[model samples]
Target chain A: MTENSLQVSSIEFSYGRTRALNGVSLNVEAGRFVALVGANGAGKTTLFSIVTGLYAAHAGDVSIMGHNLRAETLKALGKMGVVFQRTTLDMDLTILQNLRYAAELHGLSRKDARERISEGMKLNSLSDLGKRKVAGLSGGQRRRVELCRALLHKPALLLLDEPTVGLDMSSRAGFVEHVRSLCKQYNTGVLWATHLMDEVNHDDDIYVMARGEIIAQGRVSDLLAAHSVDNVTDLYNLITEDNKNVVESGA
Target chain B: MSWLAALRCLRGVITREGLRFINQRGRFFSALVRPLVWLFIFAAGFRSVLGVSIIPPYETYVLYSEYITPGLLGMIMLFNGMQSSLSMVYDREMGSMRVLLTSPLPRWFLLFSKLLAGVVVAVIQVYVFLLVAWFWDIRPPVMGYILVVPALVLGGLMLGSLGLLLSSLVKQLENFAGVMNFVIFPMFFASSALYPLWRMLESSVVLWWICTLNPFTYVVELVRFALYGRIHWLALVVVVVCGVLFLGAAVIGYDPLRGFLARKDGGPRAG
Candidate 1:
């Protein structure tokens, strides 16, 4: 089996005449946190979609846990769990029902699902809220439930797309800490897509995207040293500025 | 996937649909109300103008209400079928469809499970309509009531499959309402649902040909024969075949390689 949890080779995708992804490549290894940082339209969601098998890339290969997505799609997909940027919970169903449905979708038996749901609730401190409908939950609470649903199947590679968009500062911190702990506890590889600089932890790997291309990627300390910057914020601004200058000069 | 896992997935989907159906009272009522309005108001007005000769299944003359009741049952399934598809479009826009598609099960099985869930809801609405029509003095024979179960299921599956096909083709929610109008109106009007095929032929040869070609006609006829405790084998064959074909097309339309819904380019990416 491969060491990396996910390996996306140089992949390109286009919509009609305009390109959505331009030869992007990235990887997430076991027990590591990889932050994909990009402004809007930086192709974060598109890349996530490609990895999750929602859209096939026009060019390139994506493998999850050593299984090729195209040839062994079921096996490849079975190795991962995803929480999309948008809320996917059924608003009409209770929180427990939503989690159970997700477990069943992953082909977990009833007994296994019950055990996992309970274990997940305890892990996230989400007990006692199980009976509430998702429609009634606050934005942050709903986001936590989504996270719980994703973990019920205990997937090796967890893909989360902007999972903390509407969360408050304290809630955001809590969510981040919770995910970090889970990654370490299970040795699960995580690909977290976000635009918020605060969510990227120290020592984490970073991929900076602009206009659908991955402009820079490396460990945070290495990226800072390479860019002659002291912090990720300054390094990010410098990289975007450099790209802007090159674009302006070329045009 | 193992057989047990596939069955579990199917059960999850079906149970969710069932819960939604029970929770939404307005949706349940609306599914029945449309057919009831046609059965009571429209059929009453048309009764004086339309006289029925004793057909093979009929020992004596039948009133317009009695004749159109089976058709109204088909109408219930037809509208509910489209409603399920409309929800599918909404689901795609809201990102739940992505969750559904990402499941490890085969794409065809996932889609077919969804279609079957819709059919199950439609079948329930159909039986409720028959019960109401029964109270209105339009009851079928006792044996006929038992026989119509399979007919209504087949009709529901057929209409729901068409809904799946339409949902895959209609790209946006704003565009789906117009497409539904185009599809549902023509299907109801051109079929033998509202009037007999002979009546359609008397109006125009072209109209008759269209009514004959419409798959909804077979669905209505299949239900009608079952209500009279008989079988229309040709109509049965046509309905089943069209159901399978539409479902097949739907599965293809959802394929990630070249599916209409799978076109991520040019469209704003939904989270």
Candidate 2:
């Protein structure tokens, strides 16, 4: 509402009788890298779905740069990029072809798409692997290709759902560094969902979610200190354990 | 999006589909072989048993193999269209379909682009089958043969739209086998594909009416008539009407809000 890159106000989403998201609200300012940390079934993926226009919220509004999700999904989505949790690359396509396809889908011209894809692949450090098919790439390489595809259009807001779930430590670090560099250099707002506390830097903004709600959100260092924990993992455990105790006591 | 942007996206989808087909060479060979087997083996076996009549669009008594070439072409398109749709379901399961669907383009245009790509592949298969039919001495009139391109394209579009409609409703690829057995077979056989509608009428007028109602029957009839340098008004009407109807249904079936294609249970889980 205040010129934030993303604003989800009291969004509610349900799958049949099970409420996946319950009156969830969050906002990400422009050019900020916000990490959403939650355990499985914490509605992290569901929240991403709503934000990317994959699923409509039952009872709330999602706006991107002051444009309503429903009213300007194409325009809003055009300015946003997403890397879904699952592998979205065509296995048979070469890395370059996949990025070119994504660029074309975003309405880039053939020449422009090719140029942008080359730049994106370079940015993701995948220029050498352009001619290689996605099926032939390693998991980490594939994830990097997905990232390059997401960045081909130079979107204002980038949403990544568990982008580094199956990577080695070095690969994970490399990916995190690339993401950090993107945020710093391009002024691109990023909403990254992950459960790995080690990926959370002390300076990064963090949102800890549980049972479809944001239980805590602030700078990682600030939240950890507020919870009297030495690190993010300790802080996460304390918050989740406390929530579980509250739920059990209520029951 | 502008029309140029839509066209670019459509071209991208078609290019991707082409690359996929090219990469799966074995599948392409097998798709071509299946129709050839029906044309050579099955038709040869039934040539004498299925007595030939002076079927219109046929000047004299033609061999069963020759008579069934266009039908077999239609069959090729039909099967390939369904196969493309089947791949779509598999892609959804594998998470690739979501990538395509979530693109910034208009959802309907994205769907239409996919349908067009399927049709392009189907047309290629049909043409290859036609080449083999010629090798077997089953050639149509030259002009009519040229016209078959557009006819096959239209038929492919109609069948591809039906495939899209089915893909949206079917949640799993395993359930699609039943569709091939029930829907595909009946649609291919009940039509004027293997036999003329008049031949079907001798068995039952009701069956004749059903064939008349079938859109595939129109496609077959259109192909049959066009192959002989003749055009059937009724067949044209059927193809145009049914093609538009099926494509409209497919577009609606994929609508973000109202369509089942965009709404399914189970969000993507981290893997």
Provide the overall lDDT of each model, using Cα atoms, as 2-decimal numbers: 0.88, 0.84
Which segments of candidate 1 are over 4 A away from where they belong? B264-271
Task: Name the TM-score of chain A in model 1.
Answer: 0.97
Residue range with the least summed lDDT across 10 consecutive positions in model 2 chain B: B262-271
Q: Please provide TM-scores computed only on chain A for all of the candidate models, following their numbering.
A: 0.97, 0.96
Model 2, TM vs. native: 0.95
- The best candidate by DockQ is 1
lDDT of 2 by residue, B36-58 (tens): 99888999999998867887888
Please give the clash total of every predicted structure, in order. 1, 0
**Candidate topping TM-score:** 1
> Candidate 1 residues A1-251, lDDT tens each?
43899999989988777788889999899989999998888899989989999888899999998999999999998889898898999999899988888888888999999999999998877898999999999988898898898888888999999999888999998998899899989989999998888888668999999988999898988888887878777888899899989989999
